[model samples]
Target: MRTPPPTTRPAPPRAPRRDLYAAGAAVLLVTAAVLVGRHIQGSRHTLSVNWPPLLASWDPHLGPGTPAAVLVAITVVAYGPALAVRLPWRTLLPVAWATATAWTFSLALVDGWQRGIAGRLTTRHEYLQVIDRFHDIPGTLRDFTHHILLGSPDHWPAHVAGHPPAAPLTFVLLDRIGLGGGGWAGVWCITVGATACVAVLVTVRALADETLARRAAPFLVLAPAAVWMGTSADGYFAAVAAWAVALLALAVTGRSPWAAGGSGLLLGLTCYLSYGLTLVAVIAAAVLLLGRDGIRRRPVLLVPLLAGLAVVPTAFTLAGFDWWEAYRLLVTRYYQGVGGVRPYGYWVWANLACTVLITGLATVAGLRRSVSGLLVRDRLGTPEARLALLVCAALLALLVADVSGMSKAETERIWLPFAVWLLSACAFLPRPRAWLTAQAVLALLLNHLLLTGW
Candidate 1:
């Protein structure tokens, strides 16, 4: 009898390798760009900007290094329980919520306490001014619109004159409840921080799967962007816009008509909150287009979504203010402000570096992998592809803002909204724990080493 043919075994699946080279190249490119851009900008302008000192004392009582130590300790304590336990997917939300709250409160604790919450809340400077007259909110809103549309000097506060009414509505609500001050600002930070954490998880779950969402939770809690989430109103704006994207993702996956409508309504509100948030529409559209039933379901989704979106601007119009005309004048006003002060050549690349710093090196590496996967048509309809598209759309929006020179400074805080989506890139990292630790280190360094006026 002929000898039996030897059987060959198929090779085991290969684990994906980390793209360190790509990540290193990205870092080098950003560093080179920042150096070159600053050189050119300094050569042309007087450079009167009050940049934060590279190393500054954040808390006198604790000392500079103490704040960094405290931040490191807080991050460890916050993440310890979750890391120690094997949590069910459903149970991760509460843990994530608590971790997010602690993370933000810890970062803001020294500043909020040292500055005196009331002083922090009530003090007005540059772009942000405390609403000294709460009763005038309505009139302020009207006048703000008028200033934007007709160039009438409403004598409005810089914050009011510079942004849509929705921007100040949060503070107005806080003031109504007798909760205005730096202390309340801390509370607002924790509240919105937790909300943003939950929104991020929900969006990830909606777009991908529960397993990925659970994996993403720890990273979100320790995000380098938390350095700003603790003190910026843009933190809350990030939460709102994140949920809007989450709701839209759920709608695309056939959640409900109501979800679609809710997404549109939130998106509309975000536009009124910050003009830059309008770019999130690109993200929403990407989700809709990439979905399995996108074409057939577009009408059902668009109808209620558009109607819900129209409500916000429609109400403003009825109040005798047109959003379009207001936005038009705001563009001119924007250029006349810091947008004109900072040259585009410098900010365009510098802003990108800031984004890379905020999002973490490992996350950027993952983003590179995701984009490469897209170009080669690997896993085209997979969850990873959808997430990659979402990230790309968000980055595109930031690029547009940077190119337009509408956002010239303090992007580390102002870009918190976009950072939310970018954090999703962490889901693709090979060693998430290492990346989380790196992110924590970066946050500590930022909070301790820099004294931001914002």
Candidate 2:
């Protein structure tokens, strides 16, 4: 007769994970950024952004692309995970790219053609404005640094002055090819930017495993980063940087020397695209470290890598563009504008809030798991740890940029290259569907509600 089995007592309600706490901390950071940034901006006018932490304004409305954006979001939310899992690797890469392009294009169209795409890069502060300035390519390259200062004769616009000539030159060459103006530039950016998702998946599969790569694919496609990627040249920069890393990953893991050379070529281009992007080397180093075993086997890969690395700089030098001199002038010009007044104290932390917006709340939790993976010494070479190290490297690069004080605000768009990598951390979380929904909602809400100035 016996004693009844002791009551199970429901396994004592599982406590919240450290990931949730980390995510909560991120939410608080965003809240504090809004409240504090509004006060600082409204009172002293120093923050320089209408919306705290983001270069956007509070304008909530729907448009022609609203339905398309909503539909794309739902499609990805429902089918993305399954397709990412089942599609052949080759087929999956292009499909992921197409989906990303659709997501980015639809979000851009939310603001309509002219305001969103066709005119974004034609503004006074944008690259297309200076296409004529680059007519005498060699001459402009030689004199590019002269115009970075605010007081210089015919000084470049903020965007032009801030980046190396390679960035604007991309547009110049496009114009020469008969695809001038903001519309073609917009198409170029979105198409190339969409490849960033594929590039990251390729790298993850190369360095970690296909399983993690597959899990991460949907998150990359439906990233909140798409909001900014749709309009900014930074999106193009992100793709370039991602491919550079992906090529390096392949090269280290037994691909052809061509892969190494391509990686180096893109690495040089990435640095020239935006000075801040020089930090991409941080991520590159992580990839190499993770792939050190492969590197040890084929030490000859570095030859082609170094050879290709010389191509851009040598050509730029021959053409008269001096990367160092240009950056020095740009730093001086930085303080001549709002960068001088936007307090670092507020921005240092608020910038992380911008990161949260770009990466979404899911990434906050995902990063927690990424960090935990790094803690176990024995698992350092395991797939989870490899991916964690890669994600953390991107985070480190972004943190360095934030501390450098140059990126005070508008970082939601400005940090797209680094922030895109953060989305990969989403692969570590359980309940992929819920996290994916959170990502989609964040992106849709941001696109529908705010007029972002990417």
Candidate 3:
């Protein structure tokens, strides 16, 4: 018996999976080729009803190839983090944030201060003056709410008319602080860009493991979605929604009442920022129910979150206007405007194509692996599986948006929040560097070759 006890068999060695890496690289190259072809053809045939004229007119101040070359350089710099993945979390975090900020500024500030900042200000002011008559904050809110129910005598800013008070309230705050111009827009872009990166890391670490979070960091930093994060208010909206999910993640993992409340407040704020962001409730719910232990404590999380969400809207309701009614009226007004310009038939597929472009083709491969992982009973309860579920939730929300006809075009910016989650699918990529490169190429093509109003 003693002799038999000494006989322990040696473990078998694992096989190398180099083929997976090759497959990932191949997918990346093919995707990059497709995006390049699209960019060339798109210069001739723009899909956007609003920006067709702009796209058709080539106006690159940095010569024709300069934009592409600059983008390539930025893409190469953004890869620094992926190369340094083994570094400490503290070191990696700053690098990720810095690269993301630089990348955003590079794309956004391509035309220099005048065209980037002053020009944007001029456009905003003209639109504000023409559409809303250039009223003060209180006056603007009053008129905005009034026009929500009553059809305007004049054409109003579609964004102002459709969003809650919080949307324009942001500009009002900016004005009060003496920071109301295209320069401020650029500032907002950098601030939101950095915040989004942090929120995403926090959310990933909370929901999954630190290793996974670190792996996701580079992709988040160099997201193709930066094409819009530089100039769109939706960038700020993406940050807000991302933090909401992150706090919800914390609330579930730590079982903190305050975190739950904070999550709810942010979620409520997102609703005010954009009507469509209410769909993020799906992500919140998914986070709350992610782990087995967390399931029983869902009410503890939901109650505070709902209470926090109700606070601001409740005040708005008591002040004078009912948000529900305003949103209802907006439905009709929204369609009468862009809905007619951008048809559902074209935008439905086009938006999906934009998503593919924005998230990279490796995402498609990762998504397939995630789906397969989710389908297996043994893997169903793993963190990767739960995260995959979150990605699916975002995609499902996007599908609903495409089908609704409310979002005709401009989805590259509009889909920023969803794209954040889509990037999560990159976790399943065999070689993250390959996927990041693909994303960088796509962002370069989108920002440099194409002209978008956002």
Candidate 4:
């Protein structure tokens, strides 16, 4: 009996070189995304702020883009914690926090300077600008604070239009709390808080996991779109938060009842601020279909979940004086005509086709019997590789449609998600060298051309 000792299995060997390669490749891709993103931000300055005049003509008392910005900031702050769970904290978090603070201060300074820039305190415009702190009060304080506090929401226009009165809710509270002493002070407070939230979200996300957070951290950090948009206004941040949460829920729980229900609820909430979340909902449905067995086992909760998802439009419809008009406005307004403008003409199409082809190839390679058997051998280990592959592919297709459907050549922001997923798809390949190299070359070249306007 004493001689009958049991055997123990050895731990799996660490693939350090492979891990290094993956990490290095991810960093390289993130660097490329950051560079392209910065170029897009610079392009915004050159576009001439025509919206200012349009907005003024429509609602002279409404102020400029501050309403939109404030709404988005609140949304960003609310969702910041979710992101913090997956992003690196010690280094990247501090930078995000500091930048947000500086940005808020800058907004206040800019607002105050605009009065002096106009060189008179007596004019109606100057007087209003002074009172409002040159629109910076709303932009820096209300919106910025909201972004830090709330993260982002979908369909931001509702809160901005006073339909929900959320923005004013904050304004009223600040007034009562003696936080609204001066427009600039409110702006600074909101901006700093919003910025801190952004950092916290990134840090929290990184701290949650070693492998994923490490890889995703840089892109989230360098994603100029996320930072610039959150800083610029609150809606963009809300959209990002919605997308991030939806993905997180899916990744953590797979086809569990909580996953579908939670994801659907978040999608519905997101619909309030940004309609783009509808696409995410569509993808989630596709995932459910592919995993129908697992999804159906939780049928008792299914009907309610579906009903909740319907609330997005239902709530919006009720908001309008006439539900039909509100529904129509939500559905038809943003269709600036499809067919994304690409100056490269056929070249862009060729690039997209090639990108899709490569993605398809990698996806197909992962479908080998070996891969399938490995997944089946350990059901709890991977939980259906085919489904993951399908999701990855569906995500890629959606990105193609998303980018290609845009009406502007400078719609690179819409295209970022596609680019990110394309790289992610490549990582799934067992032999990632060829796939990664191809994607890197294409991404680098196209991004450079897009940035340089070549």
Top TM-score: which candidate number? 2
Can you write out model 2's per-residue Cα lDDT over 46-130, one digit (the tens) per residue?
A: 9889989788899998877788888988998899888877788888899999989999999999999999999999998999999
Per-model TM-score versus the true fold: 0.84, 0.96, 0.82, 0.41
Q: Tens digits of per-residue lDDT for model 4 on 160-235?
A: 3212222233344455566543353335333533342342233223222223222322222222232122222232
Candidate 2: regions farther than 4 A off: 1-16
**Better candidate number, 1 or 2, judged by TM-score:** 2
RMSD in angstroms between candidate 3 and the native structure over all alpha carbons? 6.9
**Candidate 2: residue 357 Cα off by (Å):** 0.2
**Residue by residue across 34-117, what tens digits does model 1's lDDT show?**
556556545754222434111123443433234644655465546643452356556667777776777666666545564522
What lDDT is reached at residue 424 by model 3? 72
The candidate with the higher lDDT, 2 or 4, is 2
Worst 10 residues of 3 by lDDT: 1-10
The whole-model lDDT of each prediction reads 0.65, 0.89, 0.65, 0.34
Error of 1 at 183 (Å): 2.5
Q: Which stretches of candidate 3 lie over 4 Å from their true place?
A: 1-84, 121-142, 148-151, 295-299
Which residues of candidate 1, in runs, are more than 4 Å off?
1-18, 29-48, 52-85, 112-121, 126-130, 133-137, 146-154, 292-299
Flag the better candidate by lDDT, 1 or 2. Answer: 2
Compared with the true structure, what per-residue lDDT tens digits does model 3 show for residues 39-107? 633563433443331222345344233364366446544555444456666666676777777766676
lDDT of 3 at 397: 83
